[model samples]
Target: MTGREFLEPDSPQQRLYLDGLKRIEIMQKILNELPKADQNLCYQGSYFLAANASLCGLAANHFFRNILHVRKAAIVSALPMAVIPFLSTAAVYDVFVREPLFSGQLNCEVCAVVRGGLVGAVVGGLYPVFLALPLTASLAARYSSSPLPGKENLLRFWLSVSQPVFRKMSWAVLVQVLTGLYLATKHHGIYVKILQQMNTSRDPEELKA
Candidate 1:
């Protein structure tokens, strides 16, 4: 039978064909409501995030063991200080830079770079402070007669301890921003191709044929 003739209501496969069409329609509706970039860009962005985060973690481990003369056993515990910032930075880049760029909201290369840099700087600056909290608290407990320092003193101490972490993570942040910018540019053309392919695949005429 011809393609359209096979879809006749009296045919044995009619119910299955209709069900498949309904499922496709539902999927198309969902895709229409969501951002186009979410199709492929999100996966690409996640891969970039995960790979960079892993690299940053390894680098941090090395830095702690070699540069800071930290014990190998202790270096493992301190990895969050190195890895968290990159993860957070990557998250920010995916949300602010990748989505917008691929979605066509962000068209300028300079804009993407600036946004990525800003995201890196902000996350890099703040994440270390939070990551250092446990270390700072442990240090305070170990070194001081008091279990906890006063709020002002604790704040000051946290900053001091976190400074080194921040410095190391600054390099990670820079790398992440550069990587984000590079990927954004690289995927721009790819994004268009993906959308075209998806559209062609979902064409009702093609499905009917």
Candidate 2:
């Protein structure tokens, strides 16, 4: 029998199914009304990327100036160095992965989270590399008048600076991965519920078939 024939008009299941359908319709309408550029930006996860990058920047700044006893002036000078790589990474991920996933062009939630995690790892890994640049520059500037004993010495110096930064930023990477996974799983659950509602609201014959 049809959903209306089988389910009482005032039943909770009927209400839930109707509500789910209405929400889906409203979501479609909202998406359709959005400007193309804004839609693209949202689908591409620009907001997520920007927020993550900002947090990472704040964490790095805190580590450098407070924990590591580095100068604020030095951190300010290296801000561009830290920011550019993240922006580039976010742009690439947005174009290739996030847009497709969020636009409903790609339906695999697991794949989306995997891609997000990879992006997060890349960003996390770069933290130390970029963080080292300013420190290395500062060191080189301090000894600019004297020739280094060897290029190996500079390499060692850079490593010394990077290792600690990497250690500190690892936690941020973990948090990013866990957050992405949790969001993906939550969205998947919502999607499954909507599908269940649609199925339950269909004609019994159609459901059986």
Candidate 3:
């Protein structure tokens, strides 16, 4: 399925997916309690995710030991159980980006994830404004009522319930991973076929060589 279809609320597998969100949180907690074992886990997964590109997992181990000092990066790194889809952008960040803050004082900008440079620009400029509209409207509607005290309580309720927070991050990662895997498989096959055809192309200068 396309990213849109896979992400659709109406999909048959939506419940299974929403359930996975809860699992992601549980895994993060487990990984924190067992870092040594979890480091091994991260190495295997990170290697796969990076497509065996380099020895990053080894570098991470050395950094964790003494050469560099970081007790943590984020649940994605620290937690063996943390599924990729569940991790926020913070979790996905490498040594360069700051690690996840357990303090729960997330600034909105920190949570935002962009595809690449151009997409990042779009996300930075437009997403906040788009999210702000409903939040403001809800606050305004509640505050404009006759009873001001009731309005304040209502505002609190809205903020508590409506904030996207971690769930949105999970959705974005899921969308990326699911679609990426599908297209990667399909395109890999396509590229191989094209290569084969080119090697055996009829129009080639076969007689000259």
Cα misplacement distance, residue 204 of candidate 1 (Å): 11
lDDT of 3 at 187: 27
lDDT of 3: 0.33
Q: Candidate 1, which segments miss by more than 4 Å at Cα?
A: 1-42, 54-91, 124-129, 135-152, 192-209
TM-score of each: 0.48, 0.53, 0.24
Model 1: what TM-score?
Answer: 0.48
Quantify all predictions' global Cα lDDT against the true fold: 0.56, 0.55, 0.33
Q: In terms of lDDT, which candidate is strongest?
A: 1
Which structure among the candidates has the greatest TM-score?
A: 2
**What's the true lDDT of residue 25 in model 1?**
55
Candidate 3 deviant stretches above 4 angstroms? 1-176, 202-209
What lDDT is reached at residue 118 by model 2? 68
After TM-score superposition, the amount by which residue 30's alpha carbon in candidate 1 deviates from its true location, in angstroms, is 17
Worst 10 residues of 3 by lDDT: 95-104
- Model 3 C-alpha lDDT per residue in residues 102-173, reported as the tens digit of each score: 111222232322222222122222232233334333334444422223665967754543344323333433
Candidate ranking under lDDT, highest first, comes to: 1, 2, 3
- Show the colliding residue pairs in model 2: none
Model 2 lDDT at residue 164 = 76
lDDT per residue for candidate 2 within 33-135, as digits (tens), equals 4566545444544446545655665565555444334443665545654576457656756654555543444567777667656665565334534654565
